[model samples]
Target: SGAAPRVDPRLLAEGIEASRRAAGAQASRLSPTAAPRQVPNEPVHQDGLRGLVERYWDNPLQLERVLIGQVQPGPLSPTEQAQLGRLLVEKHLSADRGRTLSRIGDEQRNYPNLARALGRSFQAGALTDGHLGYLLGPQGLGTSSRRGFEYTGIATLVAASGSPALQSTTATRSWELGAKQTERHAAVDFHTAAMRATGGSTEATQVLLQQAGPALIAAVDAVADLSRRAPVHPYTNRFSTALGTLLTGLSHLPSSQATNPVGARIVGHLSEQHLTAPALRKGFFDYLRSARTSRSWRGLGPASGNAFTQQELLTRFKDPAIRNHIVTEQYYRMSQALEELLPGQASWATFAVWASRQAGSAIRGEPLAGASGTNANGVRAISHGNTLGASEIAPLFGAFAQTLRSNPDASFQEVWRAAGAPNKPLLREAFQNYFEAYQLRRSGGGADAIAERVLVANTLVAQHEQTALQADIDSAMRVQGVSMWSLELDIPGRVLDLNEDLTGQFPPELRYLRNPRARQLEQQFGGWGDSRMESLFNLFRLNQRDAALHGDWVV
Candidate 1:
């Protein structure tokens, strides 16, 4: 007879029985919201693995991402989810991709089905081989024993058709021999047929390349369009602004407020707060280069501030003190004014007044004093109010000024609305034109000729910039090994759209100046500079000098 069971074994058995009894009595019923919990009919405890395999096979497209090394297999832990999101953003968006991925991960936590939600990220190339290796270690399997069948299916097919599975004298050996014999005969026949085909390998390759040129370029152009320019994100914006402030502050003596120790401390504090100042300033200057053409800034996008949307503003500027002291406060106020106008009520004039006042304050009590002279009322400043024959409006405002002059019939309110108010250039131009007749009186020259010459110069500058941009885009694509034809078919409209978006803040007059009509006009007449009126020319000279001086006067 078998030896009697130990007392410990008996006691363990009893405890296990008791625990099962207790668990059965206390187990809660499944809630209605829970997923269907049908146990598999098969006794195999490999989990829903079988069903997943069948489903994946039925939907081959679902396996595309997995095959391409995107969307690592298995349920993602929170960390894995974050990793996948980052890969998606980096591969897709050219902007501050890491930040975008973080945002996506944060947002998707609320999704009911984490697996399905995570799966969507795979639509784009989400997974990289490095990510998979890191996740799975030396063995490709994850925490769960279940492996992706996509690999298994391919392996099964490759192995079944090619192997030494049989030995001599066996029935299987006879069939293997037969199969080998048939394959050998087929190979000989195929080689003989190939010898009679076309010219040689080189000729065939040339033919294939020629045939593929268009499609290749279109495809490349599409990718090129997508990869055109990385966005200058908020960090870049802050960096640019800080650099600009530093440069501006350094160029001119510190304001009276900035001269004291406390003021110096405040300057340091401001620098700390505006992290994207350097990038933001660069973006601003880049916009000048970008907008020098006739491309709409809509495609270029807003630099630092959100356009018409108060969400970013509200999120960042909840504190009244911070909002009031920072220049972004001015931006927030201007944005708020636009929000007010969006409901169909016209606040263009109101915004014009607001923007002009801000510009005035920027130049107030400084060298810009004479440039701020008002008409009969303090509300409206003289349009051509250049001090000592110099225009105080920033170089950026030149385009807007031209716009207003070109379209004299347009109201200050109308032009303001069109120009996207709180937009300095638009306001500057509107104000300049509001007092344009005054500028004509001051300049002692024919208004029409000056306006014509200025318009022409503005048009040419815009055209050249646009042409340069298109050429640069083409060159970049070629450098990336992408062909132009491939890009055209795959992403024809994408380049123009993106370029326009990158320069969205630009005034319309400056955008789209490279269109065929613009070129034709330039050829028919003189270059852009010839259209400038005597007063406008004088103002241009003053602005040019000031810019040079501004550049040279830095401490």
Candidate 2:
């Protein structure tokens, strides 16, 4: 024999404990007092290693504290720390698999300590590409019955580690794995893999883009081709969704710097060939329109049989819920990409036109209470329009304004240039009108004007139903609740009696002549005074106050 084989005592001890753990038995027969105490808020030590590894593998916070030296454990060798780090990464990958990778990546971004620890272990020989691949892979979270892939986590890790080998391996494995999946799933995988490839160091990201960019574009094209081949298939719907996701990812990639030549080239290709393509735009809208019709109204039972088409279902049932959801999601994604890439006239015009249509639909559907009962047609129309306006239009306009504010340095000329220099005056005018409208809406005056209109409408309604309105007001006044300053302020008995009497009138109005001393007292000590009473007094005194002030009521 060349030499007598020997095993270290520490290795033997560790192996025995590991075996005991594997067999679901106690690692040692040490007495309770002799056993190490695992105190709370203490640094993990070698004594706590087993429990730490077993219990804290999935607990990112605790694991992070230990790795970052926040928790003072008794003692751990470098090797032991590395082992723990490796174990944590492995467990996280296992726990995180099949879930949306982007979400997992977002979570990882928040836990830099964990990433640092994993990176350290990776630098050492403790973790390999296989371990990283699993951690950074497109494997998603789900049971054998249902599985899903996520790429965000992998992207985050690749970015954090800045490892060329890991990036390359993740890219290759993602493509291979996705190729075996359905077209929609594969598209998702490819998109996420592309995102991950574009992460990491400048050199690494460049290398990945050069290697993986063409493949990603080709994959996207293939999905589009498949959609064309089977336009009516349900899979085409999924493909459309995937394409939206893919375009979103591509549009959001980091802008190129001097060091990122490959990224610039890749972005240029995507921008020219895919993002700005008329075909892609048409595809997105067409898919969304088709999706509206494809929804199944299974809940309607027999009634659904007659409404086989989406339009037929809508016409029969007058339900806009499905349409609203589908349209909002699809249009929101498209608008987001447009704002990011185009960012001016074209994007604003698209949103404005869509919003106008939505508003028109809503106005046409405005409900009217009828003599027979509730007008179902009016109710349905109003409900549909309101849903679209509230969910989609408002958010789109808000986002447009926010995008402009956030990119103040991006001038009209720049935006026009970026948008391929479309009709300048038309764009300039659109920008001006949009900003003016946005400013007006943001000012409190718009809300006040709407409130005034509503008040007038309510007054007209009350005029027609005087008796009913009086009775409602009388009932409400009787149930008057205590105010925030109930203990400090008390209403005079005569004032309460007067208010009760006023409530019985069709349009109750009360006014108090200006008493400087009383007014001063009210202003100084009436923090929780009755708002309705104040409003009534103000309304009655409005003309007098305006005449005295030489304008509208001052306060």
Candidate 3:
């Protein structure tokens, strides 16, 4: 009898989300237009849940009535799910996970209806991680029992050795535009099942992950290639988000739960083949970093879930390999961007130019904001091109360059970690702190206060603190160019997108300054920094400054 995981899988099952009807259930459901039924006198808060658990200590049957009945009818926020999990743990509600083995036995011996429905749901991609995790646990998808063999449809769908598997003849016709959609759904189902079952039972998810690895890798290559080759595919919009989820799930799987072979096949293959490539990596990461996508806190997954949260799915770059790749790819793009400006065929000059651009951008916002190769003599506020300016981009990326230069031999991952995991240095903040420290230099000054908050910097972010500081300073340094400072500093490489449009495929909001509306509006307001801009600028600056000076600013 295996002990349960730190978080109860039952809570994950029922508590994950309440509004979503479990897909593929044999039980009849209300019509789509029907109003949801609420459980009478259902627990509405944490205290209410705790009291119910305590009162029903020995009465699991009665206790589950409301939990299932209530959740089956409505939705639970991630907060509620977390609270339920904590209560279960605190109240010692967990039992031997093997306790589910008997249910599998009962189902296989007497009634296979429920079993078949769950199996069909899994095969059809109707279940997600939380649903599958719960099914593999207390809901009884089987532990190590022979009854588990009946769920081979789920495994077979994963092997994708059958039709509609994307590589197969039936799934490849040009008219069958939904081919990519089918493959992605199935892959999501199997990968999620592997993560869930691994958390619950060793034998099940291991077999799942091990079996799914080769097919998944193949599918990854195929779908990514097909999406690129035929961007007009009906499901083209979902390719990046779906692919991101797969890589993220694999990365989040701890080696302790998954076999080393599984990790090597999936993680290693993904990192080398997909992530190492520029366009593929960009598309995947764009999905992760994107805020304007269809994925949101309400429904969670890019592929609608049976029951889950965005926090639960985390298709957003959960893998460290991806993170490491992002660092490597950043420099790679930087090198490429710097190449056109490099002197004709100098062996070592590219790196030097890249370094200089880093310096030039950091100190004075350089190359004067032009397209990929042109260097004009004007404002360097991150134009649509090769120049690396700090004006429009965040200051944190500059810090990554600063960190990388100081530690020449460190791995990108190590360098980012040392610089601070998820933060880019706020240059103006750094400048202000450095100056403040200089004032107190005799006393060996300390910026004890603003040292640990990433939120404050985003405040520099939305407030356009760095933008204003750069524009004001660069307004003067256009002639002589401001000299670089903070040469030895390092910040989070994950902070900014290097102000480069890594993928030309993202939504307009993600495109930011590169969009047409901004330009048109600016033009209408009287060209650069005209009537329409001052009021907005003054609004952010004055309000933000007021909040900052009064110590009322917060994330």
Task: Give lDDT tens digits, candidate 1, residues 158-186.
Answer: 11111111000111111222223334333
TM-score of model 3 (CA atoms): 0.26
Give per-residue CA lDDT, model 2, range 1-555, as digits (tens): 122234343453455345434545444532222423222222223334544655555556666655554544322334555556666555555554524333434466566766655555666656676764554334433222223224544545544554545555555555555656665754454554544443433344355445555565556555555444334433223333344433323333343322123222222222212322332334333333332123222211222133222233233323343344333444444344333433221232232223323323333443212112223343343345434333423333334444555674555444434434434343334343344333434454343332222223222222222232343333322332211111111111212221221232212111331334324433533233444333332222221111121111101
Instruction: Provide the TM-score for each candidate, comma-separated.
Output: 0.19, 0.32, 0.26
Model 1 vs. true fold: TM: 0.19
The clash numbers for all candidates, in the given order, read: 59, 16, 8
What stretches of model 2 exceed 4 Å from their correct place? 1-50, 74-81, 92-104, 133-149, 162-165, 179-184, 219-555
Which 10 successive residues of model 2 have the least lDDT summed? 482-491
lDDT of each: 0.27, 0.38, 0.31
Tell me the spans in candidate 1 whose CA falls farther than 4 Å from its real position: 1-306, 309-315, 318-413, 416-544, 549-555
